[model samples]
Target: MNAHHPPGQTAPQDRPARLTVGVVGAGRVGPVLAASLALAGHRPVAVSAVSDASLRRAAEILPGVPVVPPAEVLARAELVLLTVPDDVLPGLVAGLAETGAVRPGRILVHTSGRHGAAVLDPATRAGALPLALHPAMTFTGTSVDVQRLAGCSFGVTAPEELRLAAEALVIEMGGEPEWIDESARPLYHAALAIGANHLVTLVAQAMELLGTAGVAHPARMLGPLLGAALDNALRSGDAALTGPVARGDAGTVAAHVAQLRAHAPQAVAGYLAMARTTADRALASGLLKPGLAEDLLGVLSDTANAASATDPADASEGPEATDDGADGGDL
Candidate 1:
């Protein structure tokens, strides 16, 4: 590993210099990132944690790293990671810059997917190098996240002059950096939120629905099915869709709606919404026959109208197998 380069200078792209790293919000993401950087020979010198969970994570993930205030963290480290929530990032950057804590030639990297390098303009004007390097993986605030970083993709944004530095930092943490244009940061984050965040909600709902339907081991039962479905979806995109909605089986879809409304009223809205989307995509792809879509769409609209008429509890899961498909398979 390359030793720390002098301040205001960068090491060669192929040789990432080991620098003193500090974490400004020791949340689920901060400690894990610092830990990953530590593995790459970067020294974690200080961390800031306000909450019990964050404090614990900081200690557990970066033992011996002094717990300090944010300003102190900036004072002691060459590379400071701002891993606060997206909503809190702008204010934090502004506050730090206003206090004159952001030193010239210091590296300020934020892990907010919703933002890009522009969010650090305050710090940038203070002469700190800015990078938005968002790792596209869920974290558990534990050592497990260190392993998860291997091969993970990061949405990276930086000034053209600092592109290589941003990429090198991500690579040192064992992540692949995908360049994100500053203007497209919000949409890029939205796509990740739709795919990863909403997926957890969908899976949790599925498990809950299964449990309510008398399945003793919901997770165990659904694990393989969901796994296979995910794999297929990743490989084939819209073509991987193979449920009642995609098949345009109005009967099965209507049955699912009725059952969800009766048994899991909360799931009715999500089901109808996803079904409508699936139907639309299916028709667009010519996978759903227009003649059959009329009935499928009718059921969705009717169910949505009914669901909106009454208040429903939050519920789980998606289209369950009601009837056999033409191939004698269930959703």
Candidate 2:
């Protein structure tokens, strides 16, 4: 670990004198990251929080850790992680820059998968090394998140001069860093949403429909099935796709639509839309005949639309809210 520390910084006898890291927004990612860095031998010197609950959580989660305001964290640490919600990042950075809270020689990083380092352009112009380091994992609020950091992939973006620092941070946390151009951020995040966020939605919908079908303990039953399906998908790619849509069984799909229409009227449209998309993918995979795919989609579409239009109350109620993949399978 000493050899792994970047040159010019002496390793601490008690803790790594690596860049003093300060975490902003002591929410899910902040405290977990602080703990992970601490476990990795780097000092997480200070953390910032705006709310009482956040401050309490920070203190409770990391006893003896100071929960200071944002400026204090920025002023005290060489590296500052702005882990605030995505919507507030630009404004927060801009506000920090305007107030001269962002210090020179400090590395400013955010954990938003949707935005690249460019979101911190204000801080960059103010002489900070702007960086984006998004860990590809959901963070459930706990010390367990520290352990989960290991072996995950991180999406990193930084200027050439600060690239090594960014890479070193990921490596220190036991993650492999994948460099992405700032301009490609949207598409990258979209892929994450489709794979991670929408997977949660799809799974929750499955569990709900399963419950409607008289399956006891929907979560327990769905867990292993979803796990196996995910494992297969990761190992075999599109070849792992299975079940009625993959098999191009229009009859099964039609029956499913009919059932949703009668029992779980609200889920009918979403089920049909997803089924159509799946059918399209199956068609691309050459698993489904063109005529059969069209016919299946047609049947689903008509039933879904008719059910949706007739029952206006049903349209507003979509699938149950899932974790948005922010907390992994548990969410």
Best by lDDT: 1
Q: Model 1, stretches more than 4 Å misplaced? A: 1-16, 311-331
Instruction: Kindly report which residue stretches of model 2 are placed more than 4 angstroms away from their true locations once superposed.
Output: 1-17, 314-331
Positional deviation of residue 163's Cα in model 2 after best superposition, in angstroms: 1.2
> What TM-score would every model get versus the actual structure?
0.89, 0.88
Error of 2 at 248 (Å): 2.0
Per-residue CA lDDT of model 1 for 13-99, tens digit only, reads 433567999999887788888888887778899999877767777888999999999999999999999988777789999999999
For candidate 2, write residues 145-175 as lDDT tens digits: 8788889888888888889988988888888
Looking at model 1, the pairs that clash are 205-316, 205-317, 206-317
lDDT of each model, Cα atoms only? 0.86, 0.79
Deviation of model 2 at 36, angstroms: 1.2
| Full-model lDDT, candidate 2 | 0.79
